[model samples]
Target: MLSQTTNAATQKISPDLPLTAKQAQLVQHILAFTARHLTTAGPAVFALYGDAGTGKSVVLAHLFNQIQVAARTQDASPFAHTENYFLVNHPEILKVYREIAGEHPHLLKKDFQRPTSLINQMAKDTVHPDVLVIDEAHLLLSQADHYNNFYGDNQLQSLLTTAKVIIVVFDETQVLRMKSFWTEARLEKLIAPYPHETYRLTHQFRMQASDKLVRWINDFTHQHLHPLPTDVGANYDLRVFDDAEQMRQAVVRRNQEVGLSRIVSTSGYPSTLDGGKHYITEGEFHLPWDQYNYTSTPWAELPQTINEVGSIYTCQGFDLNYVGIILGPPVSLDEHDHLAIHLDRYTDVEAFKKRADLTDPTELVHIKQQLILNSINVLMKRGVKGLYLYAHDARLRHYLQQRAL
Candidate 1:
């Protein structure tokens, strides 16, 4: 296993803050090993896996910047390779890169025109740059294989084959999109060759001093976390308000009471289920991904907010200091009167399959369940301090708390 170090204070140009010591150690190992390999020969496949708000991007930024610095300081050749590329800075790049790739067949190869060239175009024109980093990797493997507007390739393979030195950052918990290559089975297949180098960022730094948040997640996973007691809690400090107005008012009050940040989420609109009372929701919903009146609200843009109240997709590619997740109503946990009461975490495999719409009902559902378990395990472990959960369904809440106990 790779050594672990916290980088909660590493410098960053992006909105991402410093990583924790555990995160820093993982980043150090990857950069150190990657630098050594690039300086020598051959290739390597590396992955930085963690939960949301665990600072994966900060580490990636650190590595990329360091590589640039190393190249300049050491006076090494300008990291040459090929051309025609698609960077994952934003989810939209998936489409932009594809449109650009069609006319340039050379770009399709691994490295997206790196390492190997069709007719050595770079040799004719100019040398292409080497090494590539893809962030928001979980989005690559979304279920919506093709967005209504475009087609996407196996994002992981594209990165692996194209670049001699490829770095992928992803969190299974945030797998709210279509399918790509981040699933457990695909990950197993991809990493089978290099079993020893896999690195997982398990410690969290996004919550408060208490373990309330972490304990809440443990309700589904049958796991346990002992966070230091602080402001946030699963009991009295956290409650399910009547609606958005009350929630926001309480958030404001809490900010004043604790002298800390505060955020609020709506109960969310329901997706009526085929004329049934039970609604079918698309996980949590929120702005940008799901528009609302308050786009620029201070609480909406609060520094520590997770923004997962309405949509999980909104929280992708970013971490939070403290996530105030509001439990929305119209949640559909029963698929023909069946719910995974045993699930102690949000990403439970059985629960995930039960919620997903798959073709082969049983088979797809089974796979989805495993995927959900993987995701929940990752998401629950994200908060370093705590996890606070409030389910409108008293039974679900009771079940969750019992599992936690």
Candidate 2:
């Protein structure tokens, strides 16, 4: 069984839960920022920047809960009687937030919505919320996505027009889709006109790995593969398997020992949204991609998801006790002994959808490669207690095994 602190279903925003000193201080700062700008003319932006597993979501959850509680219950509070909404683009994450909402009186499930849904609904109602908190703001569509029912040029710009104060948690590395692509420069340019404050959380609150190991993962994600740290698995369970099946077996053992362990992969293999099982087959390892989750429960929390290989879609922003990562065909080692990303081997077509504003061929290739590497980075950082790895490319696999010794 998963511990209370590590369990996804329970480790959510709660009014009674205590925050870390740093998290509390940041929440207070945001509260003060919202109060100072509530009566201002334009939208005020409070941008919280952090990497995955830096307790970013928890901070948002706590901050939003405080906002709602003050608005609904505390008459003397500056946020009293203000309308607010919490938005996230990913469906799986939105589900988790909505489920968290159900347990609290001030938090309503309706208050938590997809970014596109909230934008369209607010426009239709001709109402502007006083406060809007966005989790996974990187997932917001940077361009108009008609298929997702967001016709606005930029979701953030649209939300800025519809809200008095907007609080967003962003991480550039977690940007997965072309439609939702974001960078520090682009984000800074967009918010230049607004009254905004930015804060970056640097602490690694999710992974139990040492700083050296964390640096190793960061270096690997940036196309630099160095030898593993000498004490790689001393404090955290780190392993590189030559065989994919063996890695899966190790992950299974970890799951049986401690819940919330699962295998995840980067973009490769046959994957599509056709409502059929797309198997990821290695030499002796075979498992289907994570099916579309119909229930409100987060995908990683489901007991049966242990049998499925989670992709970026289902696993982002969630924690696991142990993660077995399959560095797919897109990931390999080049002649210079550096990690190389092959765009052709990347099977997630949605991630590479063309954007009209981005037309330079060289720039497009760079962005695609970066996004692929970003997915690997996200998967690698999912494991709170341990991380296991297997590469599809023979040379890359050999390189990792030799370096991990």
Candidate 3:
């Protein structure tokens, strides 16, 4: 049901596709609006705002196919010459969509680019489309000079000016990097002057488990360890393990039988500098991040990466049959019997050490805490079928065991 690319209009992308009944109703409204926008002339905007696994991408994918087919066939499309493009910031995500839409040639190489790169090109490309879709807007970098020498005043404004009817698929909490700039407040301010429609996806089509899992994950994300959850619901299996090797083998076994199963974890594990070949060695398990960088590496889709691990960046915006996670050092159980975050233990916060001389101690701690929590939340929600975890902290493992009852 979930074909990477829709073969035909009749091939509905999974009946359980991440869309809720209410979201579906809003999509009808968007369809009606698109028809009107195609015939009329006015600046139009729509925001697909939802948290992780809420089916935002599924909705965008369906609309993209409908619009492209309509424009190509000149049957349902309103404009005689319709120009459109689907923009994605991550290479791994782009690869998945390209494979799904194999040889469709609807999305070009230039279409999938970092927000900075695309904005720089947008300043030069004269053919602004009538419709445009931006997937994963959270990854749009705010700092222009550092990433790509992007001298644009604002990436969001440039994108808004690039198309008449534009759609942005965004998740505010998914902003893992310090550079990305798309938050709900900023989006609200940016699209304030335009005629716009906002649709939120509430139903999570990713996990077939109880809605409690979602709430529990969110609670865990914010470091609330109370009322430890039990039972991963009627249809899900979430287990906590102490042995990293055992967790890795289980993920490998699952991947061999069904596709899209892989190991992902927080950046707490150290990467050995044996000539830039990062092998995370802890006890019996020695793992490496995907052979390719998480930004571009399609680890889940590639067979070679069956043993390699993925980070929050690589697995975000995608779903898997199963997920094996290593909670690592950033998360732990405190003496007070609550989930605690250790900024020093997480390798990601090592960068903050350099800024310690200049940055406030309190603010620095807050930033690391937030980033660690965000990454964990994203990784936890990746599995569609089941979620497996191996917490480096013994106490945290026990806590997870209680939660997975």
Candidate 4:
């Protein structure tokens, strides 16, 4: 039964999904809007945005599955009046959907690429489905930039042109690649025409109330964001450790003993030799950002992705349960007293050459510190329940604490 306060078309939340109260409310609105749009005729679209690990994808997945199941039911159900197709970025999801569809091959078509083809097939094959749901919509923007013809025009633009009803899931803050197509300006343009139809997912479902990392990030970005708790949202729990090993151990302890899901591990090295050790280590040090798909694995010798490893470059646009940040040595503050550090250089001659011309070592230090700080801010927010920090150096930990205050 729909609540008297909310839209009547909203779907009731099922018990299986562990959604927060606020998230459940939003899901209700999304489903309601979706049902309304499916029967309205012309194109309709919905947008959902939130912090990392906030269960945005999970809710969308549940709703998509629910829609498909609802469509299968008789004329008594709300969804029997409309047809639905769920499109998502993760290839794993497609496999799951295929399994769900089973031998009734006519209801679902696998290996289909074109949106037009998918929508057309759904119309011809189904009684009333015209709704399409796509997750990781930000990635679509990036893909559209590179392969514009694949989707033709931007992906969002194409969706508006094709689908009778569309739902998009994205977060503007998590744009990792510099070449992403969806900018604040572009999103503004897209939404200016439709004010009442747009919605936002604000409540954090994953991180604990103590997670203050996101507060600092939004402060920097000038975006007004808050976790569930009002006070913890003001400060960051910046823990300092002596080295990477110690940080890893602390993370393991947090997971095993404290029972936390998300922790961050960060490590930094100087890019150029200035007042510190400059040459690359002759020993077996794992290079950051290995090209061939950096999958998570535990380092028996050291703390790797034993949990989940998200580097400064790759961690953008993604969130995990727990994050362990390995703060590599050579981390320092710039003359301006902001975060700074040295970074490892991949085999990019031009980038390396640019690094060599640091007349003012202070600028390089500040840049490094800010980059790592940016990564840390993003990583810490990924945890909805809690944030644990293991700083390699006590002095640095003290500095972090002081700065966070």
lDDT of each: 0.42, 0.88, 0.70, 0.48
Reference-based lDDT, residue 283, model 4:
30
What local lDDT score does residue 353 receive in model 3, on the 0 to 100 scale? 33
* Candidate 3 ranges with C-alpha deviation above 4 Å: 1-24, 38-42, 103-114, 271-275, 293-297, 349-367
* Cand. 1 TM to true fold: 0.58
335, model 1: CA deviation in Å?
A: 15
Whole-model lDDT for model 3 versus the true structure?
0.70
After superposing candidate 1 on the true structure, give the runs of residues whose Cα lies further than 4 Å from its correct spot.
Answer: 1-25, 39-43, 77-129, 142-144, 148-152, 193-196, 209-215, 218-237, 240-245, 254-289, 292-310, 320-322, 329-360, 367-390, 397-405
> Against the hidden reference, what TM-scores do the models get?
0.58, 0.97, 0.85, 0.62
Error of 1 at 241 (Å): 4.1
Per-residue lDDT of model 1, residues 211-262, tens digit only: 5554545444332223223444433243433334444444445434332223
Report the C-alpha lDDT of model 2 over 330-398, residue by residue, as the tens digit.
Answer: 888888887878899889989999999999999999998889988988999999899999999988988
Q: Candidate 1's C-alpha lDDT?
A: 0.42
The alpha-carbon deviation from the true structure for residue 57 of candidate 3, after best TM-score superposition, in angstroms, is 0.8
Candidate 4 residue lDDT tens string, 1-405: 011212101111122446666666777888888777665656776777666656666787566656766777656767774656666543333443343444333345442133444534544653333677776565553332322234344555655554667777776555433233344456657745542266666756545544344555455333232222334643223444444455556656655543333333444433332333332221332233212232221121123334444453334434333455544453443555444445552222122223223447776554443444444556656543345554544555555555543
RMSD of 1: 10.2
Q: Which one is best on lDDT?
A: 2
